[model samples]
Target chain A: MSNKVIKYILILALAIIAAIVIFEFVSNNPDKRPSNPFEFNVDNYKAVDETLISYKETRQIAIKDGIPGAIAFSHGQLYLLVDDYLQVILPGGMEVFKRKLSEKPNCIAVDRDGFIFIGFENRIRTYDKVGIEINLSEVASDKSHFTALAVSDDLIYVADAGEKQIRVYDKKLQQKHVFNGESGVSDVHGFILPSAHFDLAVNSDNELWAVNPGLHAIQNYSETGRLRGFWSKSSFENDGFSGCCNPYYIAFLSNGSFVTSEKGLVRIKIHKESGELSSVVAAPEKFSNGTKAPALAVDESDNIIALDFDRKMIRFFEPK
Target chain B: MSKLQSRRQFISGCARYSLGLTIAGVIGFSLTNASSQQWLWQIDPFKCTNCGRCATHCVLNPSAVKCVHAYALCGYCDLCGGYLKPGHIARNTAAENQLCPTAAIERKLIEEPYYEYHINEELCIGCAKCVEGCSSFGNGSLHLQIRQNICVNCNECAIARVCPSDAIKRIPADEPYLIKGGFEHGQTL
Candidate 1:
């Protein structure tokens, strides 16, 4: 072979040897595996301090589309949520009734007489237990995004996100009074994005509890609209509201204790009957990876119900 | 002329050497980046709907979805909200009350006052029935979160965009989780 041919072959041989060495080095060492991507490792998962109760799968509730926002039960019937409508099912998971509407239904309530009241965009839709639409009334206020519904005797309380107050109406849909805002006396207008609105049941002394998550406090009130006491004041540390939306949802346990779900910091708190604060749910180690629970409901068994904003799943919790 | 031809040959050799170096550099960079940042599959716990899609919807045969326990948040009740039916047992632990469809969450008496409940990740099929029970009735001690190891980490997480509360978020790998303190006897270090 010529000298030039030998030189070219030598260069090619050198290049091939270099490539083999580099490939061998890379194939020998590998990267470490990711930690708990499925969130299955119990040793590292957070929220390890609270008491855990018995939990089982729900066979009756099936979420079809979008995430479920609010869940309620009326006359032993279970209600799961979709974006545009509320799906009503039997306790055995039978699809019995569905209330179809044009807009999204965020909050739902049923009175003692089996009257179903739902809060939708800018209006409240009332129905009999049979899923028949009764009345659809538009609130006179603008930017009135209704999110919560509560029925106390003949009075219905609607939490209007726009007006920033619990609007009071008679069973027949008459506007009787407004609890907060420019015209109300109790100054509950101080709340920030009060998403789930409700009033507690009347005690033996005819007392009730109402919470404004925006203000981070629960107010005690009488049927006559008297401000009796404030249960708890929210502090911005060690289990308090930290996000722009403030407290998203609240529910009362059977023992008179209550659970509050907050955004930003994203923790579920348990307040004792004496008003001592204890954290039942804190954000997981993978913080800010999940959305807050925007709405809450307490079943007759004192189980706390929350709709996870991120997962679009209906979550339940028992008091520790 | 022979000297001139030799000089031209040297010039061509130099140009080829430079071109090979540039190509090698580009290939090296691409390979390093490709293998280094491959841990992509993740579940946005916030956006997951607990629809049992994790059990059925994953591209993998075993479904990348697995059950996760937020142990710090658990209440450790005898009749755990996530483990039992609301009225199935009269405030006690039993087979009739557990919510796990595959009986994956196991409970053992750790001591006189405390019970240890754990999920068998291998047996878990990602049906979030237990998570729903815990979040609604109990302290939300048991929740469904994606394990990154098994996740394929698609360009778009199938469950994240559909989330109602928008709870799912991307976190860094080193300090990956958002730890919360929950129930008694639960430890987070």
Candidate 2:
């Protein structure tokens, strides 16, 4: 071949290689490639005004020894689970009684008859009004990590986040049924507990409410383990729950409203029975920004009690 | 084969040489500009929710995000909230008693009640567990900052994509860091 022809061939090859390299580089650029624009606006909800919730701080109880874990209100008293001890305190922050547990308690529930149900790592324990321990671990699975407990007139529900199932029990603590994602019921899909923050509460109408954190939803289930319905909002707005898994802890008010506490954006919010955001019980500024979700409970009078994990205290808020 | 033909050939050669030099110069200038234009990832501390995504979502094996101690804000207490777990009884330096899962914070006795806490950046996973504890109970001195040297400076930072609070942002090469408390005096380190 001629030298001129050879030079032209080499130049052509170099141009083709450069074009291929540039094409690959441009195509792979993450910025140029179409991506789902993150819809949630973080700046809009950064600092919400505290006045949105018209509630007054009625009382504050300092928990000096242990960090607050789980909280419940029953029989006109407050039950606080701190470390391995369960302290029963009066509404005025006076300690009425305290008892130690053999295992670390992850959650606490109170029955109408003054019975206390404490859920440990692998089992459940019941106690009578006089502080007598009753064994209930026989029905628990080996891998159960009970994160929340709910008690009704004749039923008991334990939220095992580790197993991702809600174990139903009778008054005698006998296992009745296990509800999971594949429980064969249409709306009774299993729990999506990403972290150990699953929580459930029995509302005034006796309907069981469970938090499906991964979906950012508050689901309602019947006593028979059938799916009733669910309420969820996933906006960065104050009305909705945001973050990986939030509204981690939930409680029901006397009027069937839901009180929820969320981590990451640490705030306490009150939602109507229809899942409409009624008011803010406490703003994010009221609590330290870095604290986890606070344990929440509502008394019979509709007073909201928050076990502030950051401050290590119980704050009572009453409607203004 | 005349003298004029020879002069014309010489001019043609010089013109070709000039064109080659111009092309080379343009390529070199573009390469220099591309290399000089550097970008660094910065986290706006106020916007950071401490969601713990920095630890797992980073491109590096161990996250480039490290817990930075704002010495100006640190109290340096013996019972440092960032160093020890809440309700921890012992004041000694033990692995189990420390709040940090990786034990990255080093506590040294500077005086009677004061202690000097240093972060071992190599061991930090940027989980922000210590930052949470410190901000909640003690002074908000401990915070997470992405180290520019360790970061690969990805075009689209993985952590920023997943950050729930939208805290991460890109800054110019001159201002590489967004250290807390350093903004008042323009300190980058």
Candidate 3:
């Protein structure tokens, strides 16, 4: 071959060798990345101090067949909404009755008469203890979502997350007046429901309280749409509510303490009547990965019942 | 020109024709039935560790992978975790307090407290800084996803090969995204 031909072959060979070496180097060392100056991590928030947790796991009841929806405690019995079925279970885990429901319900509340009031997406339905349909309310409006229901002596208050307002109903499930969180009170921006996690509960005094989750506080309101008082604390510390919206779920203890559940950090806490953090019922570490807060309810005995959707069970927690 | 020579020649011709027919059939079948089942690389948001390798390892200049917003799962908060950096002093849309390095997130006040967020795909670098902050502090409405329209669909995904948690997976074309949803979808993470 000519000298020029030999030189051309050598150049081509050199380029091929260089290409192979570069590819091998990149594929073998995957961690040779550029340093990141802007750093943030969620793992730092996952750990909770032992001193903060004040409750222990007492017992757990497994729901095997269907997806657990919500739980309500009334008259020493636990009413569970699972799939399209409403089941009643005793404190000892003995099932009282299982009856088919027409459709899935967003929430459930039981009155002193043991009549279960079911909240669908936009309307309300009531059923007797024997599973007989008592009454059904008219649809609130277009695109109304009833996320929570609370029963009083003569009124049933519904927290409509869609409308971002509270609706009052008569004993027959007939719609009465609506409270749109406009108390005209100073600094009172009324229900700041960012998502569908708004909750409502009737205290022992028949007083009405609603969770203004976006504000990380529960507001006390009268049946006549007046803001009486509220207490709020937002912090990453154990004593305060954290995340975009917290106190995602709530139930009242017999003594009027608040059993609250937070979603983003996935912790359950008890707050005193004045809205001071009482103690930790369950820490972030207690729940499985990808889990937020579970649906919360307190029985007559004040046992904190957490409906664990991730674990497919209702966990009972008592003060340690 | 013997009988043995004639028989050998005929057998060779028959074998060559059979091989040609098989190759043609395979090519035809692949064209007809392989479109719908085509697989695409996606990040499983549940398993992703937010390692920030997606922005570095992609072959493209600006990675085809971008941030996705699930509005149904969003809280529409004024203090949005995905849009603002941690320890933010003011909740305004100041360039300094934003989490995204590229200024890809757009925030608008829909009402007194509710804010709507939109992703400007042209500016996103798939750095996952916003995703990390959102997943840690909020309902996790913002997550990383490979944009189908922008992706070149390489034979081997560069980011997937170097993923630490192995969160990247080959999902069907019909279901290309792995968006995170709440209990109604039977998923929390």
Candidate 4:
């Protein structure tokens, strides 16, 4: 063999061996997920009560606990969503408490006595006013993207994003009734995004006013799961449904008047009795500028408590 | 002729050994470099959109987002502008007057006149309510930082990529932070 040929062969052999060793080491070591899985023991969670820390002279209110735009106030206490955790603001802002649930909480509601019920990802958890978790139920039969929830008296209503149906459950968590996307029944196909800002509210008439944001209307249903009526056609032209995802949050006032927050235009409109919008609570100021005003509640003073998505804070607004 | 052939053979053997050594050294160098290189996610706070999704959408339960304070530039008052709401507390401490929603921001009396504001990151949800107030009223003393201890360090962190502010950036794990003064974005450098 020629000297040059033999030299080239020896160099190639050395390179191959080196390549093999490097490949072996690289293949042996791989990126692994965190070995310490996060523990969800309720004990690991604590509440940061803003109310206790400092004093305010003008507002006279001491501290306001942080709440997600998805919150419900019951019996003068605040039930706030703080990043998957639920916090309850006590009266006088004295004590603030929290409960870490097994699943992320999307919406919360409380009865007269302050029993808290939370819904998220096709699951429902009922907690006492003191932050004690009571019941956890997987309601949606197919786990079909449970989006919105509303509880009244002894019944709990759920909106499924996956299926175009609204399922009703008794206090015992039994499937007493189900409303498919019928004329009167609210469904994703006929109403709003099944997951949009809790589209369901139980009114004094024992009828369910389900806000169908996608449909830009409110479908009414009797307690017996009967189709009663619907308000879809808007009286005002520009006042009609504003966003592709129409009314995300629906708020009802004392005199049976109500308001809806539109997503696309980022505005809030008041729906008159004739199924027309005449009052503009918050007009669209800019494009895609609207916050996630998903949860809406009316305080005793009739002020609106809205979860502002852009602001990342709870905004308090008075009706004009 | 026989002597010439022997000399040629010897030279070939030495060349082969030299080539082999050179090739081996090159391969070793490449392998060493590959093992030491690391992949990381960086945040450019400048592009951050301040989307509320950071609070809820993270895969981590608490979402590694935390509230950070710039103490060097802090106003250091008994009543911090960022820590308290728009109004002053009654001549004393009142729950409704404070600005912190979760009460995660703790205050300690550093002196009779100066106060230290510390954030309990575990309890902070990264709502940025304090950040808004501080930057607006105080010297932007409070800010949000993605804590590495709890961060899962995903192959592609959603917040870092989506941040409209472009405030996040990857730093070496050994020295994994880019500290700033009170408020640097719009405030004086």
TM-score of each: 0.50, 0.57, 0.78, 0.50
In order of lDDT, best first, we have 3, 2, 4, 1
Alpha-carbon lDDT, every model: 0.58, 0.78, 0.83, 0.59
Docking class of 1: incorrect
RMSD of 2: 22.6
Sorted into a CAPRI-style docking class, model 2 comes out as: incorrect
How far out, in Å, is residue B149 in model 2? 12
DockQ winner, 2 or 4: 2
Question: Second chain TM-score per prediction?
Answer: 0.68, 0.79, 0.85, 0.69
Return the top candidate by DockQ: 3
Q: lDDT tens digits, residues A19-120, model 4?
A: 999875654333321221211111111122333212111211222444453667677877777767887764344548877777777777776667787777
Model 4, B29-142: lDDT tens digits are 999977774534543343343344455546787668777886775746543546666434331246686666678888887644346788988788776667655543344556
Fraction of true contacts retained by every candidate, in order, equals: 0.00, 0.05, 0.38, 0.00
Tens-digit lDDT string for candidate 2 (A137-197): 5747677788999998898899997788888888788888887743224454466554455
Error of 1 at A47 (Å): 3.8
Candidate 1 per-residue C-alpha lDDT over A1-320 given as tens digits, one digit per residue, 9 for 90 to 100 = 99999999999999999999987565432332222232211222234343431232232233557667676665676666577776777655578877776677877777778888887866788888777888877564876777777776777767676666667777887777765522133332344332333323332232356655434556665544556676555344444433223355666666766666654345566666566765464344322445454466666776555556665555555534
Tens-digit lDDT track of model 1 for B85-158: 43443434556756676788888876433456799988787777777655544455566666777777676766
Residue B37, candidate 4: alpha-carbon lDDT: 44
lDDT score of residue A118 within candidate 4: 79
Candidate 2 error regions (>4 Å): A1-43, A49-51, A181-189, B1-189
